[model samples]
Target: MNFKIFPALVLAAAVTLSAPVGLQAQSDDPAAERIPIMRSNGMVLRAAPRASGDEAIAAAQTFVDNFAALPALFEDPAFPGNTQPAAWDNFDAFVGIFDEARQGAEAALAAAQAGDMNGYSAGIQTVAATCSACHGPYRRQ
Candidate 1:
């Protein structure tokens, strides 16, 4: 018997027995109930910033990604279990910031495609504004 498989089998049995009808697994389920606002922010930063080659645009993208990835430093199960992070508690606080970030990303991508460095710069700044807006509230010291 494969020892590696044993853990999976046990986990499955535990899930089958303990899980409620509507309850979902966080890791296995594709539509797991993550904070959508946070996800959108991440997408905006990662996808939109790459749309341009301008230094400021790239810097803005890098800032958001680096900051957002910080939460995973605590939340990722691969890390040792620790206290819950603030992001988990303040999911709604950053929704507006993410919305703005999304728009900026869209604009940047469009500008980058059009070879409009000015547009790209403006879009990246817009995205950075969003990230900064949210960070002002929930970001830690």
Candidate 2:
């Protein structure tokens, strides 16, 4: 084989082999595009709890049900990559914090929908505890 032609073919083969690998890795990423959206929505919703209520309580219930997705925001995509910055620490701790809050939110929404004043009050307390506990640990000034 001619040296020049051999080098060119080798380069071409390498590129062909690498392109799909890169695309496959990207496409398979579980966190891709999810973490940022979750993070943004968490901030937005927390800032405006009233937004959670503006929709009919029925619609709010649906939103509250999906709250489990919130913790994805703080996750680092390139976790363990040497060149990447540190990912958020204690994901399980953060999840516990958010899960409590999410449950309270769901409970509150449910109570409000049922028009149960006592349940609503209790739900509010639960929600407050959830927010304060998580915020105490992870929220920064």
Candidate 3:
């Protein structure tokens, strides 16, 4: 097997292994669920560069769905490590950023459906920037 494909295969395996199974009860902590979702998002983003039009559209749609759900997850009282008053403030700001990213992902999905590769690229860039902006201040190192 080509070494170039090896790492991708490993990553795919890791993601598959880490994903929550339907038979297993997930943690009540939002962070526990969020970690795997974020890892899957990274996988989709990484694959987007090489994906075909249909694949890109599917990936973008998944991103849109995931980001749309993020605000509720972040706002959940059971979300881990968000007990402080300032954390709520930070979460509010992060929600705005997440909304922006969701919009970007939606745009990417539209662009893919419309066969506009350039628009899709730009949308992906916007989404990436939004993620980085939120992570810079909020994500635990």
RMSD of each: 12.8, 16.2, 5.4
Q: Spell out the clash pairs found in candidate 2.
A: none
Residue pairs with backbone overlap in model 1: none
Q: If both were scored by TM-score, which would come out higher, candidate 1 or candidate 3?
A: 3
Q: Please, what are the lDDT tens digits per residue for candidate 3 over residues 27-85?
A: 46675567656776788889876665898897887788778656655665556552334
Which candidate ranks first by lDDT, i.e. highest?
Answer: 3
lDDT of 1 by residue, 34-72 (tens): 334345446555655455465435444443443333333
Candidate 1 similarity to native, TM-score: 0.41
Clashing pairs in 3: none
The candidate that wins on TM-score is: 3
What RMSD value applies to candidate 3? 5.4
Candidates' C-alpha lDDT: 0.51, 0.51, 0.73
The best-first sequence of candidates by lDDT reads 3, 1, 2
Local distance difference test, candidate 1: 0.51
| Worst 10-residue lDDT window, candidate 1 | 21-30
**Over 4 Å off in model 3, which ranges?**
1-27, 81-87
Q: Which whole-number lDDT from 0 to 100 does residue 65 have in model 1? A: 42
- Candidate 2 lDDT over residue span 40-64, tens digit each: 3355345434433434353334335
By TM-score, the candidates rank as 3, 2, 1
| Residue 122 miss distance in model 3 (angstroms) | 0.8
